[model samples]
Target: MLSRPSGGAVMKYGFPSLSNIRTRESYVSSYDPRTRTPAWVIERLGGDTLGGNADRKRCDFKEDDRSDACVRECAGVSVCVCVCARVRAACTQVSACVRPCSVHVFHRATNGDYRGSGLDRGHMAAAANHKWSQKAMDDTFYLTNVAPQNPHMNQNAWNNLEKLCRSLTKLYANVYVCTGPLYLPRQEADGKLYVHYQVLGTNHIAVPTHFFKVLVLERDGRQGGVELRSYVLPNEPVDEKIPLERFLVPIETIERASGLLFLPNIVRTSGGAVTAAANK
Candidate 1:
């Protein structure tokens, strides 16, 4: 049986039994604008409310809200990543400050044709957490929740992680990560924002993103990259700790544990850099 693997120690990921991974089945049948998402998915996804009812609290980032800080606090050190990256491991190259992040919105804003592909609203903070209410759940539908992630990566990564940890775990039992603000801000200088993740497994980092990033790159060195340290939330529950990179490891380790060969990204080799709007 496949078991949980953590830390820098690598596990051999042989091909998983085909039956193990369930095929994606639509949760709802007819589309109801009232319930943007199906009821089954909400229950399965661990949302507090079902039917998209505007019952519970939604993050009020709209006004003088501390939602941003709350999100950062909840994510805590990096959470164990179950998201599998076929093109090696990866993270949202999408920046936090980018404008009209929604590809649809951006297309409209630019007077350009809207492309079929879109951004993945990854909650740098997870959606299941208490921080997410019905409204929060619906709001997440906005492109803002999505960072420009390859559709395949977001689905596989979060889906697998959820299955492995039972319910999207938010702590580093085997692997630990710490993420926070950069001391000497360098937002504009590098063009790439810096967020540090400490993987207790490796006790070091080799990539710019979190646990998954360092593990996926299969390389070492922070030359063109930037780094930031995490702020410790005093007396926070262990379960709520953020999933930052506690330590860095090789992709082979992830491969062994996952039993997958995650192919490399085709565009990455062809010098295909993603063109994004400048940071606002």
Candidate 2:
């Protein structure tokens, strides 16, 4: 049932900026050596996907592979072609279809962004858990362009929520989140040094589900502030919920211990800063 709008093709999923947003034109347009670094959330790490200087790794499977997973009618007959789960092969579920993905297949996109090694199949507007909006057909939701984010958060926490939040979308459609000593492109050249996590797990998922989102402001050596702005969907956006320690505490604690809170959602107040930019 899910098909592209303009051309009536299968749809794709998306990822982040600073690790956040730009547009598809500026996104997939040819790559210039000057801007070898990716613009999307995956640029931080996953940037080295196919064209980057670094070697490819795991966690990418969920985003990179399974392009032809939709109904591909060939030879005058409608046929269902399920997408393969990984680059290698293992488990698969029709629900986990990649949409606003963060990597690329072809070496170059029509946008002119020369498909380079650092490129990723990014999704401008996430393809997963897309019931919230209907812009999938627009280039805004295209998988060729998106932002940079932690691979773990993109696939596991964020991705998990996409499926889990399906039924509960009625009660609390979206969740705003702010997790770390956030960092972004203007802030760092190579992108964040630490990995990001969506403030998920046990307690954080217990919110009443309204118009709530987490804001990640970076707090450097001198308590600077948060930076990134991202959101997560809960398994069940129960109308009756609270800030249970299950989700809140660990987030704060992780940041205090971390020295530099470049990777937002992962750190909390109790967590230490991994960077000594201020203390020194």
Top-lDDT candidate index:
2
lDDT by residue (tens digit), candidate 1, 167-270: 32222112111111111212556697654422111111111121132111111133222111112111112232334233223434433432333222211221
The segments of candidate 1 whose C-alpha lies over 4 angstroms from its true place after superposition are 1-115, 118-121, 130-132, 162-280
Candidate 2: tens digits of C-alpha lDDT, residues 5-100: 211111111111122122221122112111222222221101111122222221122212224433231223322223222321343322321232
- Segments in model 2 whose C-alpha atoms lie over 4 Å from true places: 1-119, 131-137, 143-145, 148-153, 164-170, 173-280
> What TM-score would you give candidate 1 relative to the actual structure?
0.24
Model 2, residue 64: C-alpha shift (Å): 21
